[model samples]
Target: MTRIQSHPVLGNTSERLRVPFYFDENLYEGYESETIAAALLANGVRMLRVHEESGTPRGLYCNIGHCMECRVTVNGESSVRACLTTIENNMKIYSGQQLPNPVKRMVEQE
Candidate 1:
């Protein structure tokens, strides 16, 4: 599936910049102003991440960045809100399954 060609309210999306980006190492095109979630949806990629604890499949919910459901890893960073991050050319997106390692504080033996 391709991006929305035309909408009743917002028409003529051709003017927007169509840049290529990588989602899970796969290349896909996305508009400049489009968010990461929008870009993924355009390429028929609904499942972006999974719940860390339950391992449940997840995707876009609130596209306003308020919800963390759309969280994805942009480049090397993790827990980035897909709805808030705009797509850029050659941006490498990830599912954020392997989150950043937490800082471990070494404790003295009691």
Candidate 2:
């Protein structure tokens, strides 16, 4: 998917540097200074994590780092906020885990 063509409030995102990052082993690029969740959403990735008990998929909710729905693993660190975490070059992000355990994806029925 393509990045945001132009943001009404932010103007043009093309001015920022396109940082390369890995999400679930897939290569994606996002503008510099943009949050990890923002980048992922722009690239059409909605599922960010899974519930520990229910095994349900979770994505961006309160993008201000309060909802705790966008938690993801960053560089081996667990429970990192995707909405507040900045996207860095060569960063690795992974979902599908409830803390340390891999849970079923949101699309799965069983």
Query: Per-residue error at 22 for model 1, in Å?
Result: 0.3
26-84 in candidate 2: lDDT tens per residue? 99988889899989998899999889777788888889988899988998898899999
> Over the stretch 82-104, how does candidate 1's per-residue lDDT look in tens digits?
98898988999999573333342
- Taken over the whole model, the C-alpha lDDT of each candidate is 0.82, 0.86
Which one wins on TM-score? 2
Give Cα distance to truth, residue 53, candidate 1, Å: 1.0
**Number of the top candidate by lDDT?**
2
lDDT at residue 38 of model 2 (Cα atoms): 88
Enumerate residue pairs that collide in model 2: none
Error of 2 at 64 (Å): 1.0
